[model samples]
Target chain A: MILVLVETDAQGATLVSREALTFARETAARLGDQPVHAAVVAPLEESMATLVMKQLGEQGVAVVHTADDERLTTYAAAAHAAAVVDAVRAEQARMLVAAGTPRGNEVLAHVATRLEVAMAANVVAVDSVEPLVVTRQVLGGSALEEMRLDDAVAVLSVAGHACDPEPAEVPTAPERLGYTPSVTDQDLVARVARTEVTVVDDTAALTGARVVVGAGRGAGGPDGFKDLLELTELLGGALGVSRVVTSLGWRPHHEQVGQTGSRIAPDLYVPCGISGAIQHWAGCQSAKTILAINTDRDAPMVTKAHYAVIGDLHEIVPAINEELRRRK
Target chain B: MANVLVCVKRVPDTAGEVLLSADGLSVDARHVGYTVSPHEECAVELATQVAEATGGRATVLSVGSEDAVEQLRNALAVGCADGVLVEADADLLGPADVAAAVAGVVREREAGGLSYDLVLLGNDAADTGDFQVPVRLAYALGRPVLTGISTCEVQDDRLLARGDGPDGTEVFELPLPAVVAVMEGGVSPRYPSIPGRMKAKRAPVETVALTAARQGSGRVRLKLPPSQPSSVEILGEGPEAAPAVVDLLTRIGVVGR
Candidate 1:
């Protein structure tokens, strides 16, 4: 049996979780029809739970194990790890899969440490289950490493955009199990003190945006983003900045795109005045199409982009925005 | 006063193009220079600030080849007081081995009546991209651990850490004698000055051998990702390219023609 940890967002199961489910489904099929189970650590809110269950069922999960408790509402790594470990034991799962998101990776790390098992993270491909051959992203997605997990339970986290989420041809009704693992005072030692949610406008989130207009140090100053924002609005996308921009206090850190900030796989990414550092490239490398607008023709972003426009973005962005408006 | 231990890794500077070896077993470092990983640089900076504020000593540690002493000296030049080199083949050690070696150092120091109040490490190394050592070390030491922390403050006997979460910033309060895995961009690392470099060149880096058993994860091979074919087409220069950009956007379905 294979157990997958499914994490949900405000609306329902997130894209990364769905990706994990998809990965688990395919891996199970590859392993001669092994059963795939999903373990969710959440509050079990009626409607939310229903939505999650339906999604997991559609994804062909044989069983859905939910560790629903008041303390589980917020992320407590120890508590969540305990729940996953319990679920793994309950199902006698030989493989545990999770999304490579921050929470997914962190919680699974705790599980690995607690169980004293080996884990491979950011796995992009699974070769075989017998010896557990897998390919994982290393050096911040610059290279790939093939690894084999020799442990009894091969714990791994699939990289983002590794697989697409698809529903089963014939969906099955999954058996739902409510699991509550025993927790100790030591488990609560590193609990969340509080969470401050910064609500951005609906279209401003980098992950969900289909088009992203990126800015960098060449953006000059805070005022420089005005045209970029206009371009983003014109393109029906979000505004993303580089690490330097955020570090300079020109933009909020949340809007920064790099290794430390959001990793976006958008349909189109237009980087303006941004010299693509490897750290920044790690975030936007997954975009379907990249167009660089910069004055320097030899800039890394220019060389890496599919399309390049050589000019000052201050003049060029407004021109494009005006051209787009004129076409409209 | 708190005694902090900051773990740093010497990695190939990833700012330049990273090439793979012909054998595909390791990164081709013939052309690339080495530096402390960015996140670990920030960790050293944070440790320095924390020690300065609390009148404590910041000790930097690394488990790598003999040349890793250069990285330790760099850290000392930045602000660290002392350095320790756990002489080992970094390429042969997995996350578990690294954790065990670090745990051995911690135990040995504690035996010598020097107990660290806070242990700091990069959230993940840039080269290996392994997000394991900090948590594993914490587990080995039986200490609470926090990963991917961007902001941290020391308050009396406790520490406050903040990281980005799905919704917003998630804050964590950990008691003393805890482990923290710091992410980059928390603080800009300072460059080594002339006098600092001179002092660092003279600083003694205690070298020790790993008493812990080596752990292997059965790695098969390291391969470079297929080079993305990018044939950049110039859409013209200046404002005249605006129409071409619009046409391209429409072609990509980002806009309607």
Candidate 2:
């Protein structure tokens, strides 16, 4: 059997989780239709649980397991790993999968350590299930490494944007199992004391936005972002900045996109005045289309972009905004 | 006083172009220079700060070939008091074996009455991209582990860690004898002075051989990703490009024509 750890947001299962489910469904088919189970570490609130189960069933999960408890509302890494290890044992799963998000990788790392098993993280492709051959990105997504799992139980995390989420043609009504694992004080040693939400507009989330307008050091200063913000507003998108901009105190770190910042996979990424470093490109390379606007023609961003405009962003942004306004 | 251990790896400087080896097992390091990964540089700095603030000692450790002593000395030049080299070919050791070696070192030190109050590591190594060693070592030692931490403080009797979440910064508090994988951007790592480098050159480094059984991750080979086809069409120069940019945006459906 194969097990997948499903991560849910406030509404329901996240896109990355669905992507993992989609990958799991295909992997299971490749392994002669091995049974695939989905597990969630949450409180199992009735309505949220129902929605999540329905979604997983639609994704062709054969069984759904929930480690429901009030304390699990906020993630405790050790506790979640304990629950996952128990689920893996109960399902007799040979392979376990999760998204390569921060939480997903962290939780699965705990599981791997607790089980003393091998985990292949940021895996982009799964070649086989028996020997567990997989391809993962390395060197900040600049290169790929093929690895095989030599352990009895293999744990893997699918990289973000590796697979497109597709619903099953014929959905399965999954068997639901509710479990409550015993937690110890040691397990709660690194519990989250508090979480502060900074997002003012839901549509402005860097990762979820459809279009992102990026500013960098070339954007000049804090006042320089005013036109970019206007342009982002006109394009119905979000405003993103590079690390230098944030370091210079022109923008918040939350708006930075890079290896150390948010990784975004938007439909359209318009990077204005941004000279792309490898660290910055690692986050935005997944965009379907990239348009770079910069004065330096030799900038990495301009060379790698699908389209380029060699110009000053300060002058070009307001013009685009004006044109967009006229069209509206 | 607290005793802190910081784990570091020597990785090819990623600032330059990286080329893959012929067998695809590793990067070709003939022309490329090696240095500590960015995150681990911060980890060494943080360990030094914590040890200094708490009136303790900070030690650096590496599981790599003889050349890895260079990285260990780099840490020592910064602020680490001592260095330990677990003699092993880093290429031959997977995360499990690395963790086992570290755990072995920890046990040996503790047996010698040098119990570490805290263990520090980079969030993930730059080359292997393995996020397993710190957690695995923590589990082996039966201690608490926190990864991707940006800010850490040594309080009276506990360690406080803060990291950025999807929402905002998430705070974590753990007792001593904890393990933390620190991320970059938390603290600026300082460059070593001439005197510090000279002192580091004279520092005695303890060398230990790892007898742990090698548990391979079944790595097949390494390969460069297929380069994306680039056919960038320059629209125009200066402000004159605004109309073309708008047209292209319209064509891409980001704006209505």
Candidate 3:
């Protein structure tokens, strides 16, 4: 069995979890069609359970394991680790995979260390020989390294937001499985603090959008971002911000792209007044096409872009908006 | 309290557009000078804050080459009284092996019977950005962990952290003797002065390297990041086209159905 552990919240399953599940399902299909276990820490209320399975099944995941023990209620890395360890042993897990999000990285790291096994993190793809080989990015996005880890039970953390969660058009009814924690006092030590949760207004979130219009510090601020937003709506996409723009707190972390932030694989990435830094580029490196607008002709970001516009985004953005409107 | 062990690395300034060898894989070390990684600096800052609040000793550690001592001295300047360098030639090893090398250092620390409260690391290396080390090291030490912590505080020996979660910003509090990967801006690392630098230079630095994946893993290929193509398409008019644009807007799915 291939265990694909998912870290979820009221915001639903994270992009990374879904991506990992997708990867796992593909891997399973490759390895003689294996079973995919989608584990989440939640009370198995019928609707909630159905929603979780629906999300996973859409991505080719079918098996479902829910850890509902109150002790497993919150985001306890140790508890999750412990629970996963038991599940792995019980299921005789062939390989363990989770999307490479914050939680996925931490929990898998612990499992790998505890098992004294090697882990491949930030894996873009996996190739198997006598031992399984994984390809992952390093040094932000500048380098790609390949390694074959030789362990019966291996764990991998997939990249976050690598792929948007697309619910399978044909919903698969999830089979509910229960798990009891084999976690010891050591596993239970990390305090899992529960707090009131608030939801993100993703109405404008750029996840999986066909087009993303991004603004940098030079767009000036929210006003420039507003122009970018206007353009996005005109283009049928979402607005994106660079690390600088988000640090200015002009936008939330979700809209921010970088190694330390979200990774967007949009069809088109339009950068405005944003000086592309290596960190920021890592998030959008997977973006299909690039369009940049900057006043500095020699700006590095312009060079990284598929199309560059050397002009003031302030004047330039409104003009593009007008042109798109005129064309309409 | 958690026995936390924080790992940090020294790296050169990456934003300067430094070029690697023609193979384009390894750093053209002659030109670049090393500095404490930004995320690692955050690691030191966050560890110190948590240690101060929890009354635990925040032990700082690193793995690098001889000149890496210079990097260790930087951490000391950040107010980590003591530092250790698992001095190794990390030029060729992949992250899994690097994790093993770091795990050896932590094992030595544990065998020495130092009671750790937790283990922490920058979420990723500033230069390489591989995030496996902390979790690997933590697993080697058999502990739980947290990663990408943006905000952290210690209360009653439990570490409360706020960071980028899957959905949004999620909060987590875990008991001590764990691992954490610090992110950017979590805390401001203090600046080192002439005296701090001088004092750090005098302090003894520990150097250790476990056996790593051997030389010639296969020649690595280096190439510049693929170039993006772009052009500036100047629009016809400004706000006057707002309606025309707004009309196009509904067409694009932004303003209307």
**Candidate that scores best on TM-score:** 1
Model 3: per-residue lDDT, tens digit, B9-128?
A: 767656546467666567675675667666777787777776666666666777767777777777776666677777676666656666667677667777898667666778877665
Candidate 1: residue B148 Cα off by (Å) = 1.2
| All DockQ scores | 0.65, 0.60, 0.33
TM-score of 1: 0.96
True-structure lDDT of candidate 1:
0.87
Ranking by lDDT: 1, 2, 3
lDDT string for model 1 (B1-257, tens) is: 88899999877777768887777777877687788776898899999999999999899999998989889999999889889999988877788899999999999999999999999999988887768899899999999999888778789999999877777678999798899999875677888999989888888789999899877756788987887666888888888899999999999999993
Error of 3 at B1 (Å): 12
- Where does model 2 exceed 4 Å of error? A198-204, A221-223, A246-250
Error of 1 at A151 (Å): 0.7
Positional deviation of residue A249's Cα in model 3 after best superposition, in angstroms: 7.2
- What tens-digit string does per-residue lDDT give for candidate 2 at A34-64? 8889999867678988899899988999888
- Candidate 3 on A65-180: residue-level lDDT in tens? 77757766656676787778877888888899987766677778667666656676777777563457776666676556565666788778776554555554445566767877
- Using TM-score as the yardstick, the better of models 1 and 2 is 1
